[model samples]
Target: MDEVRVFPIIITKNKDSSEYPYFVEIPDIDGMTEGKSIADAMKMAEDYIGTFSLENKLPDSNTKLPRVEEGAVVTLVSVNVSEYKRKNDNRVVKKTISIPNYLNELGKENRINFSEVMTAALKKKLSV
Candidate 1:
């Protein structure tokens, strides 16, 4: 099951630049990220919040919305922290496993990718 957290974000158009125009502010994490469009900005905000939540403890969503200025949009961004981490965390660690000598020799001879096989087996066993 995915644990979803919703955070409020303020998006404003960047008048200074046209290439990357949308700017997002995630107040809960005190984080800021920008994107090329509104949808992109929202996605970036979600990613920022997810990364922040994974790294640090996050406070409960603020019930009282922040004051919105003219031409600024306030919206809720929901992120599944667990799913986000699973999708975004790519750091790999080495693990030593003991396999039968014959199987190991066969795998080497067949040029099998042990990492891919292990990952697929684990994912299947875990039903992820």
Candidate 2:
């Protein structure tokens, strides 16, 4: 699957309240969220989609977008699924690894953090 996904969103003025003036509709996912401003609404939409992507519940992007209505703004919001998952999935797992005794001793002498080093190396190798 592509790392990034873009979805169409509709933003409308919330006539009911002035505090959160924007109402965002994510038609693709059949979801809605409110924001105090246009920028905030867009961000909420991205976050909502990112959460859904993590759950493997995102709908096909090829689905037809809802028709634009008067006084409503239609735009696209893009999220990098891989990046989102990397940032939000923070559970850590322990592993057992073996290395040369001399290298391990040298690392200990230098007070290196093995887990941190391994994480960095893995991230670089995977380009995440």
Candidate 3:
């Protein structure tokens, strides 16, 4: 069996960019830091946590949150229960995926996710 560990995170507003007013991040650990802001950032954080939780088999338990201080706000975020359950039941893995040369070339040309292109192709192929 593998051991699992959980860490705390902090969110703060950027000093420079007012438009990007929030960040979700774990504290520095061995020099790994991926920061996010705005709605998309939160979503990215969710995906990141999902991956981390899956890899570490984080427990499906409510966190023992600390009491909030003055001038602080707490926002409740939601995730798909089925997705969380699936992550809890599986282990994260690293694997390389293969794509057609044309797909790869087009992705490079467009600077977009190969998955997005693949999804579009599949949709068109199936006449969806």
Candidate 4:
């Protein structure tokens, strides 16, 4: 089971031409990132939270929101720590399984990717 947590953030639009368009800051996690659009900013925020979840103790879901500056806009972004770990963690663990010889031959003949197929099956089984 996974618990999703939300973090409060401030977004500042950049008027400079060279730098990224949006600068984001999440005070609770002491995180900051920049993006080119609102969507990118939100995704980066989620990524920052996910990374923080990996490096630190999972904070309480009810953690208080951090105060924002007068000109900055505030928002809450949520990330699923367990889900993020499942998707992003790179340490690999190998598994062994068996399939019908004929099916395996057919897959190989069709150039099917066994690892992709296995991962999809496992993720579906785990409801990930």
Q: Whose TM-score is greatest here?
A: 1
User: Which regions of candidate 1 are displaced past 4 Å?
Assistant: 91-103, 106-128
TM-score of every candidate relative to the true structure: 0.72, 0.67, 0.39, 0.68
Q: Which residue ranges in model 4 land beyond 4 Å of their true spot?
A: 17-19, 98-128
Off by over 4 Å in 2: 62-65, 95-128
Instruction: In model 2, state the lDDT of residue 86.
Output: 79
The order by descending TM-score is 1, 4, 2, 3
Model 4: worst 10 consecutive residues (lDDT sum): 58-67
Q: Write the per-residue lDDT of candidate 3 for residues 25-98, one digit (tens) a residue.
A: 53322112234454565565555555555545444433444345453333433445356656456443454679
Specify the poorest-scoring 10-residue window by lDDT in model 2: 57-66
Q: Each model's C-alpha lDDT?
A: 0.88, 0.87, 0.51, 0.82
Clash counts per candidate, in order, are 0, 0, 0, 0
Model 1, residue 5: distance off in Å is 0.8
Clashing pairs in 2: none
Instruction: Please give, for residues 10-125, the per-residue lDDT of candidate 2 as tens digits.
Output: 99998998999999999888889988999999999999989887777676564346688799988888888889997888679899999999999999999999999999999999
User: How well is each residue in 1-103 modelled by candidate 4, as lDDT tens digits?
Assistant: 7878877778888778345788999887678998888778889999988988876986666446557667666788889988998788877678888999999
Candidate 1: deviation at residue 81, Å?
Answer: 1.0
Candidate 3 deviant stretches above 4 angstroms: 1-10, 17-21, 26-37, 67-73, 81-128
